[model samples]
Target: MTKSPRFMQIKTYLLDKIESKTWPVGRRIPTEAELCEQFSVSRMTVNKAVRDLVNEGLLERTPRLGTFVCQRKAESPLMDIRNIADEIKERGQLHHSEVLSLKAIKAPEDVAMRLGIMLGGDVYKSEIIHFADNTPLQLEVRWVNPNYAPDYLAQDFTDKTPNQYLVDNCPLSAIEHTVEAIMPNEMIAQRLDIPLEQPCLLLHRRTWSGDQLISAALLYHPANRYKLSARTSL
Candidate 1:
């Protein structure tokens, strides 16, 4: 096997320190010169490692104070159907949700296509806003196949998220996701408490349970306040 890159090795060393709390958040890391001496590497190699960490949001550079570990951006896995509430709780923050609407409705054309149902078929629709530490984080507009989740509209979303309830009833077997960045419309802007011109990330997701399409959702988040990340190894 080929040897790993020198910069990658240095990066891993720094990451190990941060993850172990040997270099806790807000604690300034050693200077490039110091790292270069300690690793017996060139200053350019040390700079590259630190720069990569900064770009990845693990370290931040101060004008004259040096680099320090910083609190990471709120993140969700791009390839996973994770519960927003659980993610917030894992970060040691409070999670709250508000149900804007929940009722049965005739499936709209787009919703019908996504859920693989008739255009006018009966379906359950719900709109909810999830908050992390009372700051709006996501707006979820979902349409569910009544056959799969008959009691979807009856449950209180504030007490439990739609995702949580769906998992219990639907037992997700497959999921599809499409992500894009777009300027929020008036209502989306107002709900997310951001200016209309500010860009937002939109995730269109469709889920299936045992080969039956169960639910489709449009999830929106403020671009600056939330991030999506995915990791994989061969």
Candidate 2:
């Protein structure tokens, strides 16, 4: 318990830098010596935090160079974001989805807190695997506010993506996305056909149509096959 908070503090500091885009990918971070001074911590403490991030694919260490933020596996625009289905179609790839589960359930605490609903309130949950040209590309797990999409569980996801349906039905005002690298569990690893050693790009998204939170989603992609890119005008 004593070591937990200190290491977490160090980890949170670095993660905040990456998540806020303050320390963009490819930017070399401060050396361990520098971090020790900045955080007033010991070398071993710094090493533990840094090593954990390296394993998560957030930081890369070179033989002589200091640690740097590694590239994200999938990129979306900072302002405007496109639905995954449309992105695949634009690339001329055959896009298909396999809906694994669709049903109404009580909102989990984490989800309810984000959606501004009761902890046990009804929410529609959807688990889907998206394929690009027959290759497993994404595992999409989404939680929907039934108040926004009452018929979410009744619709067939294979015909239209959960994201697309929400876009069509809701009046969107804001979208928030947080990207992180995560090592998958056995189930996710097997489903993605990727080894546990490989880090997966995990994107957490929350959508709001005006004042109502519409949906929250966790999107996962194998790191080797996916990278987030954006091209936009100033």
Candidate 3:
């Protein structure tokens, strides 16, 4: 049998430690040099092992400090399209939003593809930061098909969320959602008030109203602050 690569072995060792609570949550793991010596491997191999863990949200790095096991994330159902404000209120927390941008713009390549519109086609865009009890909970960057909701740019998102407005105006018939754990970009990190190195749970969603594509949205949530879950009846 072919032996597993050294880096894979190292990664498995680290995963076992974290899963078993041998390196309990919030406890810092050994430095690269220490891991290299312990495993009798190059620093490059040890770094690869640790880096993968960080990317997976199993570990995190702090400047001027070592890497530590991350805390358990708060969960949100992955299949739900419920209003953020209603969800927060159900949790007994205040919900508010900051509408950073709301305007009609020429669609970029990705936005055009997602909305099934021609490149450079006119589309309504909005960037909003949603808060729960004063802490940033989500950063919503959305592109809307103006044909579906002509007044998308005019609504006051602070008083009513884009989701609520769209549900009322368009009446969704179908929806698609894709979820992943990813490192936040600078703007997303800044908007969500998280560090650039921190992992984030990204949800890409598309909605359709009676066979007409309505909106495409990228929702970013800080990984340490949030997680995605799912359940279904058999």
lDDT of 2 at 25: 77
Better of 1 and 3 by TM-score: 1
Residue 84 lDDT (model 3)? 85
User: What C-alpha lDDT values do all the predictions have?
Assistant: 0.93, 0.85, 0.90
For this target, which candidate reaches the highest TM-score against the unseen true structure?
1
The residue-level lDDT of candidate 3 at 36 comes to: 92
Q: Where is model 1 more than 4 Å wrong at Cα? A: 1-53, 58-71
Question: Which residue window of length 10 is worst by lDDT in model 3?
Answer: 71-80
Q: Please, what are the lDDT tens digits per residue for candidate 2 over residues 170-191?
A: 9779988888999999988987
Clashes of 2: 5
Per-prediction TM-score? 0.74, 0.66, 0.69
| Model 3 ranges with Cα > 4 A deviation | 1-74
Better of 2 and 3 by lDDT: 3
Top-down TM-score ranking:
1, 3, 2
Q: In model 1, what lDDT does residue 44 have?
A: 94
Q: What TM-score does model 1 achieve against the real structure?
A: 0.74
User: What lDDT, from 0 to 1, does candidate 2 have?
Assistant: 0.85
